[model samples]
Target chain A: MAKPLILVSNDDGITAPGIRTLVEVAKKIGEVVVVAPDGPQSGMGHAITIGNTLRLDRSIAFDDLDIVAYECSGTPADCVKLAKHHVLKDRKPDLVVSGINHGSNSSISVLYSGTMSAAIEAAIEGLPSIGFSLCDYGHEADFSHTREFVEQIIRQALQHRIPENTSLNVNIPKKSSEPIKGIKICRQAHAKWQEEFDERLDPRNRKYYWMTGNFVNFDKGEDTDEWALVNNYVSIVPCQYDMTAHHAIAMLNEGWEF
Target chain B: MAKPLILVSNDDGITAPGIRTLVEVAKKIGEVVVVAPDGPQSGMGHAITIGNTLRLDRSIAFDDLDIVAYECSGTPADCVKLAKHHVLKDRKPDLVVSGINHGSNSSISVLYSGTMSAAIEAAIEGLPSIGFSLCDYGHEADFSHTREFVEQIIRQALQHRIPENTSLNVNIPKKSSEPIKGIKICRQAHAKWQEEFDERLDPRNRKYYWMTGNFVNFDKGEDTDEWALVNNYVSIVPCQYDMTAHHAIAMLNEGWEF
Candidate 1:
C-alpha cells in the first residue's frame, strides 16, 4: 500500500525548529510535504491574503531532510490553502499536522493562533488535522519530550479517523521534574487575554501602542485544557469551525421578540 | 434612565458606507462611540496586531453627528480591544455592533470575516454583540433597505439581552422588489469557498497568484443561514467564540489511546 500523504505546516516560519521537529515526526508516519509561512505568524488567526498577491517559493532549507518543502509569503491559513489547491492539487493529503509551536495555544488563545488556524483551514477543506503547541515561548525551547506523544496521537488519528469538520488542538506543558503526565482529552477553557497596551512615543514623536496582555482563565472546570496543562498533562481539545452557539439559539428564540 | 452606551466598529475601514450606516443605526439606540480600522481589513478573521505598534487616531469624520469616533491602524478585533481597554476605559458598553458589511458573512464565510471578528471579540469580553452584513459586495452597495431591520435587531438585543458569551451574526439580503420576510434565527450553513487561484506574472517577471474562490453550500437544511438569505429573510445566527466540538470529544475519548 502507498504511504499516507501528510501535509505539515506551522505559524513559526518554515525554518523554525518547531516545524523541523514536526516534519521529522510526520515523515515517520507518512510522505511528508511541508508548506508554511516564510516568517513567524504567531497571532495572525484565520487571516488570508486578500487585496494582496501571494508568493509560493520552493525552499531548500529542508533539503537535508527527506521531505518536500515550500515557503509562502502569506499567513499560516494561506499556506495551507496554497498547498491544497496548488502544490498538492492532484493528490489529497491523508492528514494535515501543524505546529509543535514555540508557544502555547491552549484555552482562548486558540482564537488568535496562526498554528491552529492552519490546522482548522485543513479541517475546513475536509481533511483530518491537528495543531500542536508547547507551553514554552522561547525561540530555543526544547521540544524533544513532545516527540513520543506527537507520534502516538498522529498514529491513533490515522488508525481511527478523526471526526469530520473537526481539528484537534494539542498543547503540551513545558518540561518539568515530574515526568510529563499522560495526554488528556479536554474542552477549551473559558479564558481570555486581558489587554494592557504599553503606550510609547516613537522616534517621530508619534504616539503608538504596543499590546501586552495577561492570560486569565475564568473557568474552574477540571475537564478544561487549562486544567490539563497546569497538571503537566498534554491537552487535546477538539475544535470545530461552526461558530454557532447552538444552546443559545433556543434562549434567543424565547427572549427575543423581533 | 441613562441612554445605553453602544460601541460601533467594522472591517471595511472607518469611512466605509457600511460602518457609517451602522453608526447611524447605533446612534438612534444609544450614546455611540466608534473605533474601527483605518483601512479595509477584509478576511482578517479574529486577528490581532502583535509584534507591531498600533495607532489610534481620533477622526473628525463624524463631527456633525452625536457620536465620538476614532480610526485605528489595526484589525477589526484590535479595534474592539482598543475600544474596550483604552478608548472606553472607565465605562462598559451596553452593546457592541459591527458592520453593515459590504458582503455576506453567512455560512463558512464567517470564519474569514473581520466584521464578525469585532462582534466575536466583544462576545469574548462578555458583552452582548451583533455583527451585521449585507449580501451585496459592491463598495456602493445599498444598505438603506437594511436600516429598519438593523435598528429593530439592535433594539431587541438591548431589551432582551443576548445569551452570555454569544453574539449574533446577522446577514441581510441585498435590496429586492419584495420586502424582507421578517428575521429567521438559524444555524450557520455548512458551506465553503472552492478556491481558484488566478496565476499571473508580475512586472518583475515573477509568478504571483491572486486568490479567488466560489461559495459552495453543501448543506441542504432549510434551517440554515444560506436558506434564510436566499428566501429574502434576514438570518441571525448566534455565534460564539468557543470552537470546541463538544460532541466529538466523547468519540475521541472512546477511540484514541493515550
Candidate 2:
C-alpha cells in the first residue's frame, strides 16, 4: 500500500521548532509536504490574504530531512490555500496537519488561533485535518514528550478519518513529571480572555496600547477541553467551521418580529 | 430612561460608506460610539493583534454628526477589544454593531469575514451584537433601500435581546426594483469558496499570487441563509463562537482508540 500523503503547516513559520518536530514525526509515517508562514503568525485566526498579494518561496528549512517545503508570506490559512490550490495542484493530500504549536489553543483561544485556522481551512476544503498544540509558550518549548502522542493521534486520524466537515483541535499538556493519563474527546469550554490594554508612550510621546489578557475558564464541565488539559490528558475537540447557532434559530423565529 | 449606548465598528475602515449607513441607523436608536479599522481589513476573520502595538486615533469622519469615533491600526476584532477595554472604560455598551459591509458575508464567507469578527468579538465579551452586510460589492453600493430593514433589526435586537453568546450575521440583498420579501431567521448554508490563485510576476520578476474564488453553495436546504438571500429575503444567522462539533464527540469517543 502507498504511504498516506500528509500535508504539514503551522502558524509559527516553517522554520519554527514546532513544525520541525511535526515534520520529523510526519515523515516517518508518510510522504510529508510543508507549506507554512515565513514569520510568526500567532493569533492570526482565520485571516486570509485578500487585500494583498502572497509570495510563496521554496524553503531550505527542511532540506536536510529531504522533505518538500515552501514558506509563504501570508497567514496560516493562506498557506493552506496556497498549498491546496497552487503548490500541490491536482495531487490531493490524504491528511492535513497543522501545528504542534508552542502554546495552548484550548477554549476561547481557538477563535484567535492561526494554528487551528490552518487545520480548519483544510477541513473547509474537504480534507481530514487535525491541529496540535502544546500548553507551553516557551520559544524553545520541549516537544520531545509530545512526539509519541502526536504520532499516535495522527495515525488514528488517518485510520478512522476525521468526522465530516470537522477538524480536530488537539492540545497536549506541556512536559511535566507526571505521565499523560490518556486522550479525552471533549467539547470546547466556555471561556474568554479577560483583556487589559497596557497604555504606553513612544519617544515622540504618542500613546500606544499593548493587548494583554488572562484566560478565564467559566465552564466546570468535566467533558470540556479545558478540563481535560488541566487534568493532564490530551484534549481533542472536534471543531466545525459552521458558525451558525442552530439552537438560536427557533428562538429568533419566535421572538423576533421581523 | 437613559438612551441605550450603541458601539459601532466595521472592517471597511473608518471612512467607508457602509459604516456611515450603519452609523446613520444606529444613532437614531441610541447614543453611538465607533471604533473601526483605519484601513480596509476585509477577510480578517476573528484575528486579534497580539504581536504588535495598536494605535487608536480620534476620527473626524463622524464629526459632522457629533458622534464619538476612533480608528484603530488593527483588525476589526482588535477595534472591539480596544473599545471594550480602553476607549469605553467603565461604561458598558448596551449593544454592539459592526458593518453594513460593502460585500456579502453569507454562508462560508462568514469564516473569512472581518465584519462578523467584530460582532463575534463583542459576543465573546458578553454583549448583544449584530453584523450587517449588503450583498452588493460595488464601491458605491446602494444602501438606501436597506435603511428600514437595518433600523427594524436593530430595534428588534434591542427590544428582544439577542440569544446568549451569539452574534447575528445579517445579510441584506442588493437593492432591486422588486422589494424584499421579508426577513428569514436562517442557518448558515453549507458552502465553500472554490479558490484559484492567479499567478503573477512582480516588477522585479519575482512570483506572486492573487487569491480569487467563486462562492459555491452545496446546500439545497430552504432553511439556509443562502436560500433566503437568493430568494430576496434578508437572512439572519445567529452565529456562535463555539466551534465544537458536539455530535462528533460521541463518534470520536466510540471509534478512536486511545
Model 1 chain A poorest ten-residue lDDT run: A59-68
- The sequence of per-residue lDDT tens digits that candidate 1 reaches over residues B32-68 is 9999999999999889999889999899868889579
Give i-RMS (Å) per prediction: 0.8, 0.7
| Candidate 2 lDDT tens digits, A161-228 | 99999999999999999999989999999999999999999999998999999999999899999999
DockQ of each two-chain model = 0.87, 0.92
> For residues B34-69, what per-residue lDDT tens digits would candidate 2 score against the true structure?
999999999898899998999999999999999999
Give the worst 10-residue stretch by lDDT in candidate 2 chain B: B43-52
What TM-score should be assigned to candidate 1? 0.99
Candidate 2 clash pair list: none
Q: Write the residue-wise lDDT of candidate 1 on A1-258 in tens digits.
A: 888999999998998998888899888888999999999888899999888999988989789985789999999999999999999999999999999899999989999999999999999999999999999998779999999999999999999999999999999999777898799999999999999888898899888999999999999999999999999999999999999999988998888887
Q: What is each predicted model's overall lDDT from 0 to 1? A: 0.93, 0.95
Displacement of residue B33 (Cα, Å) in model 1 is 0.4
The collision pairs in model 1 are: none
